[model samples]
Target chain A: MNIPLNITKTIHDWLFSIMPEGVATVTEWVIVAAAYLALFAVAGLYLVLLERKVAAWFQLRLGPNRVGPWGIFQTMADALKLVSKELTSNANIDKFLYNLAPYFVILSSLIAIGVFPFSRQFQALDINIGIFFLFAVSSIGVIGILLAGWSSNNKFAMIGAMRSGLQTISYELSVGLSMLTMVLLTGSLQLSEIIEVQRTGGWLILQGHIPAIIAFMIFMIAGTAETNRAPFDLVEAESELGAGFHTEYSGMKFAYFFLAEFINMFIIASIAVVLFFGGWLSPFGITDDITWFPETIWFVIKVLGIIFLMMWFRWTFPRLRVDQLLTLEWKYLLPINLVNLVLMAIIIWLNWTI
Target chain B: MSYFSDIYNGIKTLLTGMSVTGGYFIRARKGSITQQYPDNRETLKMFDRFRGEVVMPHNENNEHYCTGCQACEIACPNGSIEIVWDRQVDPETGKKKKMIDKHIYHLGMCTMCSLCVEACPTDAIVWAQNYENSVYDRKYLTKVLNQPGSKVKAGIED
Candidate 1:
């Protein structure tokens, strides 16, 4: 709570001094909510542009350079195009569920973004159950995909949703187990406390060494699947599903789904940075005294590096068949993750980890 | 034992694939194959042998090599080329001579098979490297291959 001259606290104090206590709390929460929404609205847009640019580079091409300088405003132009498109509606589709699904998908990703401790002073919520909350909340995103597919009154959409649900559910186990391995080392689920442990012990990947590396690898693979991305992206396997669960969605509603996909990617990368790379912790204690460069900058740099890694995975690998996808989770990731968790426990018990 | 090896091999192949793409990503600045089209138009040059469109080459004296033999017109599968010839009195010879009035080329209908160039006896028509043949109206695609105020070379005879 002793954040050094944090802007959020300063604003809260100023608002409290000006207004009555009850009204001040509500108004402050409203303003904070608005700020979070605005921050992510821009972040989601640019993250997509970055993903495209990264994919383009991997394939030896310039992704976008038309909308603005280096196509910086490419996503903005895409947003305008999506907004201008007509929302085609079908009579047989379940209207309520069809409309409700996109909000749920966007909500899960945006809410998870709040749990990240961007800097010492930048966390919106420093809940003790931070890691647990992120898993629980992000899992609901699969439900949105399911609803979208089921309500669209399209067979292809239904198949895509079903695939997504299956992939996320199975992969969630590996993601949780890998995270549990790290939690065993840190002995705390709070994201801030995990960073604090890493600040003292160095990054978990370095400190815990072999087991942490295994866990990190497993986590990344499962996290990729959890987000319904390639090579595990059987959900909307464009060749087969024609855009998957959100196939029936168009215009602004489709944009919501697209934006949520990238935001979820950001959330996953943030979590990876927090747990394994040591969120906001300067490498080799190099930048500890460098007041000019903030911890948030380090956090962002690490998160972007991980996001690039994910993009690398996407462009490099082909889509796994549905069977191969499930086999990857059940036969490969699950077993390795369970064994890695056991190894992590024994290492901690023996006081052998650095 | 095999299970452990399976996991190891799986990770090994995945990393190998990642390295290939990672290398390309790193080398992108030096190795990108992107042609920035309109931006690089001024510097862009077509290959000498690129058969973009056929043209009747005119020299500085406003004369071309076309004899209006109609061989190119006969070779065209799509009838994209039209040769209009007329019997005109040759001033020097004092005899009626067949001279080409116009050679029309409809680029819209052209398949660019290079058959016309192959059939031209005098090499009057050759492929021009200008590929940007798109026009707003379809009628604009029909072009007169012979430049205005041009005649057949005086020394060219059947």
Candidate 2:
């Protein structure tokens, strides 16, 4: 692992030459962020169109197919329409906090994009504590959601934000803990190191022990809740709370929140890949040997697979009630994760590495 | 007792709860659920009373009963209706009569409440089954019910 500084200098020179000049770090982050924003736009488009299509299939009706080919551009058109609309904030709430909340949530979500190992050595910041940094950074959006609810001066947005705050905070405990178990076993906080561990020892999903299995499940479920997607989607329970925290927000600010949700979805899915499934690691590490397929392809495949599974979950079930949501969290997820951590320690002691 | 009670109780409840989500996760539909609307619009069926858009009826004699009555225009709540009026002198009576000219309705503005059809006394305008009303410009929406220069039937003046 002793790489020469000359090589490192060469890479630094190469990256500087290739990437845009002036605030290179910020520029790289901007690229990373813009890439994710574009992805959010695409995913939101797919998600909306797919949600409509899925709903139609569930109800035995045709969905939006008149916009583009198979209504592919329908979500785009809807987005354009929404953006053209007048953004209105009606209440006399704390205007500063009301406005800043969405930006904060959105900022936190976009910040999480940097930590993803899109390919080997192809991340925004190869920060040492990338994994923990991600969990810490991503969780700040909860504060934004809560502040949005509180600042709106509306009872429903506040309650939704409060529920989102508590729910995400509680689940994030397990997400962090599950990851702590990985850092403990792998002995590194870096995402690349975690991937290296999985690369050598196989993905944590196949880590052939009770603790790994338990941790993976906790991360997946908690991650889903973290994104405020369906089943755990009580934050903006449309039937009850009228579009949740950003109910009063409109136009591009609302678009930011909307885009952030999808970005957060990708972020959580990437974490799940890096921590559990395997970041850019292919089946039996077959693609690991192939020279043509860069490590990023494997990463995208695994990430997309997880995203697809989430989308499948989103369209399949009805929204869970708030009590059901808490029960699922406080009652079910937290305890299993705790036990799973304990079980993982025992497995590591037994040297039962998969 | 209280030490293990917190998370231990949570575990008992979570296992109880996950069985539900796990069950749902397993029991989800095993097929794609996307519907291509325009591609299959020709085959798509509409409900019995699905009000789409308004169209004037064309008879075997090529005569439309719309007698220049402005009830539909007045009745529309969204201002979606606009009637093109052409004055014609009747050959039989040698008198100028306002004939039901041309109709230009913006389907984009149409709420599909069937108020226009209800307001028309001559039963001229009826709801058409055509729901695919995607248009680029706002101008192409108006429909001319009667052929230009086609004489309005002899004494039909409402």
Candidate 3:
């Protein structure tokens, strides 16, 4: 069933009624931005805690249990510690670019969070070019990483930044092509429209059959690489580069880079949710009759599932060597992605989509 | 065909790896092998042969088997054991005999080699199972093993 409540729209109309149009719109923008900032900050912290706990379980160890029940407050305490720490850096660093780098990384993820259709009528920016906008903003984050590396005046950081640039550029093609393959089935780049199409035609993974599944596999791999996660984490290869590009960053500045990574992972997982799994659309409409169970919950559940899957990849696979990383992208993922895109187009053309 | 087969085998191995971790995750609550140290102190038991520290055993009458022979003192590699002795008249036998004034043990220098325990012909010293041996003062590590006013067991041969 469709979302019964339009809480965001109701609040918008109420604000416009009491104030002038310009004032109301600006006020609404401020509120939405503030809300998204809070949402992502908390989500990033908990995702870190979740990663530690999941890793512990996989290794058959008890994770953080010292803080508030089951170590819920461990990340909170860590964030506090990071905040109070002194912001130390090398004296030889470029002041302008060094200061600007973290904002570039964090703001891009926050902006991308705005376009997601959390539930019906709950989207902040329902732009027609939603998928393109996400891709554009996500690519901007690598510029931040590059700048952080270059400005730090450290060789290890510089090497990490270079690796990040190479990895992201290679993976972006597969990420785009895989999404493009799914776009062939839905015929729209707008995320809300994509979900709406899935609502009527069943999930794209089932409808488009083998090609869709192939696209999904490629998308997950590319998406993980895009976020600079493990197995593809040559960017900050702890063993080789010693924390990669942000080695010189300390205190809250380092935290900004750390938080941005988790938020980027969320964004990638959200995109996967919107495309492959039906975004906010219940499976077979089982819970459609229960109006109290919101569509937003369903959207969150799917996003978290994809995030967990990514985490599983992180803890399971070993990091790829620099050359192997390149070979995998160019020889393996890219070729498969291109053929899958063509296959999806043919499936749609011949009315063979399930 | 080999290229596709390589990809197939790679994915297969990866899945096998995931299954192993996933199985551990499923049984995580019971499978965790972490020993919460201080919390489990009541239940913690060291093996019988664990050489934690050296102790001189005393019987109910506060009498020990040591004849003040100083074999353990010579056998100790690091000079961890020292025995002070003086000749005294045996009350029952009315003859002069060697007796220990103090049996000093320096826990700090002891290497836990069990050599001193083995050198004792009378089996006076044995290894204690208590591993928590830390003390705030270095002086506390220098222990006097013999009790105050305690004597050697009657009829013990040197």
Report, for all candidates in order, the number of backbone clashes.
Answer: 0, 3, 0
For each candidate, the DockQ is: 0.75, 0.11, 0.60
Native contacts recovered, in order, as a fraction for each? Answer: 0.83, 0.05, 0.69
* Chain A superposition TM-score per model: 0.97, 0.87, 0.97
Query: Mind giving the per-residue lDDT tens digits that candidate 2 earns over A43-116?
Result: 66675576566555544456676777777888788789888988788758898888888889888977778677
In the range B29-140, model 3's lDDT, one tens digit per residue, is 8979884445456787878899989998999999998999999999999999999899999998999999999999999999999999999999999999887899999999
Q: How well is candidate 3 docked (DockQ)?
A: 0.60
TM-score of 2: 0.70
What is the per-candidate TM-score for chain B?
Answer: 0.81, 0.69, 0.77
Candidate 2: misplaced stretches above 4 Å?
A1-64, B1-158
lDDT of 1 by residue, B37-82 (tens): 6556567787888988998889999999998899999999999999
- Of all native A–B interface contacts, model 2 reproduces a fraction of 0.05
For candidate 1, report its TM-score: 0.91
Q: Candidate 1's residue-wise lDDT over A1-354, tens digit each?
A: 334336677988999999999999999788878989998989989999998898889999988989889999999999999999999878899999999999999999988988899888788899999999999999999989999999999999999999898888899999999999999999999999999999888899988899999899888888998888888778888999899899999999999999998898888899999999999888997987766566787888999999998999999999888898888888888887888899989999999989
Please name the candidate that would achieve the greatest DockQ relative to the true structure: 1
The best-first sequence of candidates by TM-score reads 1, 3, 2
Better of 2 and 3 by DockQ: 3
